[model samples]
Target: MQFQIENIPIQEVKLDFAKDVRLFVKREDLIHPFVSGNKFRKLTYNLAEANKEKQDTLLTFGGAYSNHIAAVAAAGKLHGFKTIGIIRGEELVRKVDSNPTLCFAVENGMQLKFVTRENYRKKTSEEFLTQLTEEFGRFYTVPEGGTNDLAVKGCAEIITENEKDFDTICCAVGTGGTISGICNGAYSHQQILGFPALKGDFLQKEISQYTSKENWQLMNDYHFGGYGKVSEELVTFINQFKQQTGIPLDPIYTGKMLFGIIDLIKNGHFAKQNRILAIHTGGLQGIEGMNQKLQRKGQKTII
Candidate 1:
């Protein structure tokens, strides 16, 4: 299948925290109307590889509202592959389940299967694979958030095309694929900085195994909560950014990373003389109905 590439927008933001720090945001959120940004790179390249290898079905894992699953479902339907989303949690919903991101994924044609926390843990077990192979009839498995070699290769293409000399390339690290690719793709003179979306010491080893840039490092202080968790501060930052730049950032991913990078610059972690490039690995769909939810909690947006 021939996948379409999104031309995400790019803009430079000026910051008062440093003497000469200018941050450029590659607005990958604008990449696609439904599914966008890094998802394009993650899926496009892999699908091409699958086609080359003559694979018919694609299987992947994620939470109920995983951006990767949504993108894959959409991509698979457009291409000619069967896509299955092995959601992390059971299909249980608390009353106000307005997570537009997951809803969009269903609309795009994903077969959702809910599993218990313990069962989900066994998703990669030999027993699970054997059973799934019998059920799925041979499929290619993609890691959560599409963090794999092919996806990273696609990200590398993004850097080669940009050809900018920004001193630092900053992005939110969920699976570490995009940042790893940027580190691998960047010129030796630039630094590739990442803010973890999960709080744990393991992320260092996880990312280090994939990248070798001497200037690359992980910022551990930021993650509001582990994947899919949210907080008041994240909402505040998202609203503030949207008010100033008119971009919507879902609390689940990009918003948190962007908020942290700017804070780091303010705290003198980033050098004033260095230019920064921030990647917006779009997850806009997750923000659907976010305003109403926040309003119920009496949280007023910057807008």
Candidate 2:
């Protein structure tokens, strides 16, 4: 399966609180209808590898609203490959209404295999891998959030496409896929700071599982409330950012990463840095529910 890597332009803006901190966003959110951001970069090589091996099926893992799953499903279907989604959590297929992400996956011919939280843990185990291999027949496995060596290699290519000399590159760290790929490309010169969305003390180990970077960092302060959760401050800031810059940030991922970057600039994190390029790994639809929730509380959507 072949996928296109869209060259999203660099969007530069000045930081609100930090006078010296100049901010830029690589608008991966504008990459595609589905295969946006780091998702496209992460999947590019994997899709090529699958095509080289003549594999007909692409199998991957994610939650019901997983951006990774959304990307893989759309890419696979668009390129004439079968897609399988090993989704986390129990089967809510019949009980709960599917969200836009899940609906997109289904519309794109992605077969859903609902797994319990416990079994989902063993998804990468030898036993489960064997089962999927047997069932899918020489299927290509893309890990959750598309974080693998192949994905990282493809992500590294992003650096060459853009001609900028930022001292720091910041992006939300989810499964470390995008950040790892970025670090692989950016670690030699630029400082790579990953604002993680996952909780638990094991996040650093988890991040290192994907990339090898000496100058990389993971911020522990800005998770807000783990993956898929947000605070009122974040919701407010997201609203303000859109109003000021006309950019919509989903709270689960990019929104919080931006919040951390702003806080860092305010706290003197970018004092001596020349520039910071923040990767906008798109998750716009994820904010639909948040928009509704905030609207119920009388908060308006700026975008």
Candidate 3:
């Protein structure tokens, strides 16, 4: 299987506060429809390795609305590899039709295997993997969020000579593969700022395992509540940002990251005349599912 990626475009975000501190966004989200953003980057090498090993089946893990699961499914279909998703929450098995992400994965020919939260936690355990191997036969296993050495290598390519002039590089932190790759590819003078979608100090250690660079720092205050969590303020910001910038940000990752970046800019966090490049890692597929939850709660939805 072969894949081709183009040079992603970096568009300037014109805001009032951005006058002194210029803000730009690397539109990694435009890489592909389903296999877009960092997902495309993370899977580029993993799929190559799977092809190298002559593996016909790919198995990975994720939750109901995981971007990784959707990307893997689409990629497998495009590349002619059978895909299997070990989905968290066995209860979601019956709700697949209502969930946009899972539905999309299934439409792309991915076989879904739903497990309880407890079993899902053991997904990386040797015994559990042994059980999966026994049930599904041999397969190339991609970790949750598709973070691995090869994934990091692919993400490192997100930065090129075109981005060398930026003072600070920014991206949302999930499994840390994307940021780690950015850190490795960044110039010595550029600072990498990671806005984690999930709240935890463990990401510092998780990211450190991939890159030894000291140019990156985590902004832990923008998580809203936690992973898969969003608020009215964040929703409003995402909607207004789209109206102002003509770019849509997923509430799970990009929305929070941009929100925090803009907030920082307003509070004079960045130095005057600083050029900031924020990566738009795509998770737009999860918007439908998130809107479903927001509507159920009688809250504002992403527009």
What are the TM-scores, per candidate, against the unseen true structure? 0.89, 0.90, 0.98
With a 3 Å backbone cut-off (N, CA, C), the pairs that clash in candidate 2 are none
Rank list by lDDT = 3, 2, 1
Pitting candidate 1 against candidate 2, the one with the higher TM-score is 2
Q: C-alpha displacement of 242 in model 3, angstroms? A: 0.3
Off by over 4 Å in 1: 1-8, 93-99, 289-303
Higher-TM-score candidate of 2 and 3: 3
Judge candidate 3 at residue 121 and give its lDDT: 98
Q: How close is candidate 2 to the true structure, as a TM-score?
A: 0.90
- Identify the candidate with maximal TM-score: 3
Task: Give all candidates' CA lDDT scores.
Answer: 0.76, 0.80, 0.94
For model 2, residues 1-303, the per-residue Cα lDDT tens digits are 333455667898666556666899888788786787788888888999999999999999988677888888889888889999988888656632436677778888998888889999999899999988887777889998888889888777777647347888898988777777777787467888889887877767766776767778888889998887777778789988988887878888899999998888877866565688888888776666566556777765424
**Model 1 weakest 10-residue run by lDDT:** 91-100
lDDT per residue for candidate 3 within 1-303, as digits (tens), equals 333366777899988746688999999888888898999999999999999999999999999999999999999999999999999998998899999999999999999999999999999999999999999999999999999999999999999999989999999999999999999999999999999999879999999999999999999999999999999999999999999989999999999999999999999899988999999999899999999999999999999
Clashing pairs in 3: none
**How does candidate 1 fare on TM-score?**
0.89
- Distance from true location, Cα of 4 in model 3, Å: 6.8
